[model samples]
Target: MTTPKTNRKSGFPAVHLLEEIAQLLAEGPRTSNELVAITGYTKVTCCTRLKQLEASGQAYRVVAQASVTWYAGRKPAADTAAIIPRQPTVRDYPVIGRRDMLVQAFFGAPRECRA
Candidate 1:
């Protein structure tokens, strides 16, 4: 009914997101920050895409630490369905979830641990 969507600004082929994510994980598992550092996408965007790759069976989570997680991916099926993110990852909260990522990343020790 409608054409497939790509990223908002870069206008790069959208599947490139899926494929690139998979290729990176081919080597081994990596956290969202690792993927963000390598890909230069915001942590938000990188994380959102990784989840998509996972949903499509092209990627999977490997581990977690603090508020971040590691993931591994594989080349996607030719017939795999693709769905664009609900919103561009440029927003702030979902980078790692609004619950406590800021505290976990910045504060490190929990309030209980600090006092």
Candidate 2:
């Protein structure tokens, strides 16, 4: 039997990354670090695959603690994706406000007006 192909740098099963990750998820949702430990994959690779799974309807994510994300084998609801915030347009803000004009006039005046 041939040895399993793995990433040379990370010692992670390069060819079967997703497959390995899915099997790990079978036990339960796992934190990014947990995946890294189990598969010997880099943190970045594990997190990246987790996001891909979450996006492709194969996995979901949850907050385990403060800012800790765990990946579970499930799909998120249609509305779970974040809604993009509306960008502020030029019309949203006026170039000069009433207070700004008043302040400018009070602090600055034409040479003749200063007298």
Q: In model 1, where is the ten-residue run with the lowest total lDDT?
A: 76-85
Note the clash tally of each candidate.
0, 0
Tens digits of lDDT, candidate 1, 18-83: 677778888877878887777766778788888887777677664445755545544343235354
Question: Model 2: residues >4 Å from true position, as ranges?
Answer: 1-12, 67-71, 75-115
Full-model lDDT for every candidate: 0.67, 0.70
Q: Number of the top candidate by lDDT? A: 2
> How many steric clashes does model 2 contain?
0
TM-score of 1: 0.46
List TM-scores for all candidates, in order.
0.46, 0.52
Q: On residues 1-115, what C-alpha lDDT tens digit does candidate 2 reach at each position?
A: 8888787655756767986787778777777787888777778988888777777767777775666555555555545545555666656565442445687689874334344
- Cα error, candidate 1, residue 90 (Å): 47
